[model samples]
Target: MWGVRSGSLVRRRQLARTLRELRVHAGLTIEAAAPLLDFSPSKLSRIENAHQGVDVHVVRSMLDPFDVGGDRWSEILELTREASAKGWWRAYGLDDRGYIPLEAEASTIRDFTVTYVPGLLQTTDYIRALFDASFRRRSEATRERDVTVRKIRQERLTSAERPLELLAVIEEAVLHRPVGGPAVMRAQLARLVEAAALDTVTVQVLPTDVGAHAGIDGAFTVLSFEGLGEPDMGYVEHPMGSTHVEKEEDVTQARLVFDHLRTVAYSPAESVSVIERVAAQM
Candidate 1:
C-alpha cells in the first residue's frame, strides 16, 4: 500500500535530528544558540525540528558552535545537502508527496503485506488490474503513470552499484487472489518464484495455518538506508491515510513484529513450493 506517499519523509529528518543532537550535546539551548548562528530562535527551532530546510553554508557554520570537525563534520554537511535534493520521481511529476522517494533511497526493505501483492513485485498486468480494481476512478493516463513508477522502482532490485535487498512477506491470500483473473495472478506468482531465486531478494509466505502471529496488526514496512546516520523507518498504510514512524521504540516494535512474522512464515524454498502449489490449483 503506497497508500499515501506524501508524508513527512520528503525532507527526511535525519539532518534536523542530527543537528538537534549536536546542539544538545554542545550544552546549548535554542535561545542561547540562536544568536551564535545569527538565526532567530524560531528559525533555528524550525531547522532543528525539520520544519524548514537549512542551507549548507548555515550548516557548516553550525559546526563551530558544536566543535564538530573532520569526518563527523563532513557527514553532517552531506546530510544537510541531501535534505534539499530532489528525487528522480520529480521529473516524472511525482515528488515530495509519498513513500516513493524513501523507497528509492532505501538500501533494504522489509515489506509485509496483507492485501494484494507488494508493489515492487507486481507484474504489469497485475499492476494494471490492481489500479483498475480501485474504488476511486482515474484517467487511463494516471493509471499508466502509476504503473510506470512501479516499474522504475523495480529497477533498483537489479542495480549494479547497490541492488535493493527486498525481504517481502505476503499473506498466503495474496497468491490466491484472482488479481487480474487467473492468467495475471499466475504470471505474478511465477514472477514471485523467479524473484525469490535472486541473491538479493527473499520471498516468504505467512500461511493461514500460522493462526495468529506478530503481524496481526495489518501491514507495515521497515526501510533501512545504506548510510546516512539514520535509523530504520517504519511505515504503515491504511485506507484513510499512512504514517511514518521514526521514534526508536515504534520502529523497534515494528522490527520485532516483522521478525516474529518471519519466524512463523514458510522458508524461502517452502514458500516457492507453496506458490507453485497454489498456482497449480488455479
Candidate 2:
C-alpha cells in the first residue's frame, strides 16, 4: 500500500487485507462487524474482498471499534480516501474490469497472446483495426476512448521512476495474419521491433511450427507487483468477460504456463529478427 495510489486495485486489496486482519484481531465476525458499522453483511463482505470501496468516514467507524488509533488509524483513513478516488480510466468511460488498476501497479507484466499483439505493444492503427473487426460494433467515440486508455496504459512501460518490465510471447501465426491490412501490420511489426529494443521489454515469438502447445488454450497475463506482500495475479480475457485469478495455486499454474512458453518460444533476439523479417514481407 505504500506505493499504491488512489483507485488502484492493489490499494484496494491491501486495504481489504488490513481491515480483515483487524476484524479478526478484534475477535469480531463479519456478521458482528457489519452491524457495528451500519453496513449490510453482504456490503461489508464486498469491501473486505476488494470488490467495493470504503469511505474515510466508514473506515474510521470500522476501525474505532477495534481500538485502532493514532498513525495506524490515520494511514487506514488515507488509504480509504485514495481507494474511493476515481481512476483515470473512469474518465474514458471504460468499465473497471480490474485489469487496468492492477496493471498500473504491476512491476512486471508477462503476456502470451495467441492471435494478436499484446495491447501494451500494439500500435494505434492496429487497435483501431481490431476493434473494427469485432462482432460487437462500437460507436466511434467508444473506440477512440478505448484506444486512448490503451495508450495511457502503455506509459507504464516507459515510466522513469519505476518502469514495468514486460515479457511478451506472441504466436508466430499472429505475425502472418494481417490485422489492419498490410500497411497497418507492417507498422505494428515495426513497432514491436522498436519496443524490443527497450531494456525493460522482452519480446519472444512462439513459432507456428511448434504445434499444440500449453498456450493453445487462450491468452493470459500475469502481473507481478513490487513489495506489497500480495501474491501474483493472473488475468484472462474472452468473448464473454475477463477473469482475475488471485489464488496462489492458480497464479502459480499460470506462471508455469508462461515459463513453458518462454522455453518453447524463440529467444528475444531471434524474435526481433523474425518480426523484422515479417515486417519486410508485409
lDDT per model vs. reference: 0.85, 0.88
Model 1 lDDT on a 0 to 1 scale: 0.85
Candidate 2 local distance difference test against the native: 0.88
Q: RMSD in angstroms, candidate 2?
A: 2.6
The residue-by-residue lDDT of candidate 1 on 217-262, one tens digit each, is 7999999987656679988888787988889999999989989999
Candidate 2: tens digits of C-alpha lDDT, residues 165-257: 999999999999999899999999999999999988999999999999988898999999887667899999999879999899999999999
Return the top candidate by TM-score.
Answer: 2
Every model: Cα RMSD to truth? 4.0, 2.6
Off by over 4 Å in 1: 1-12, 21-27, 61-76
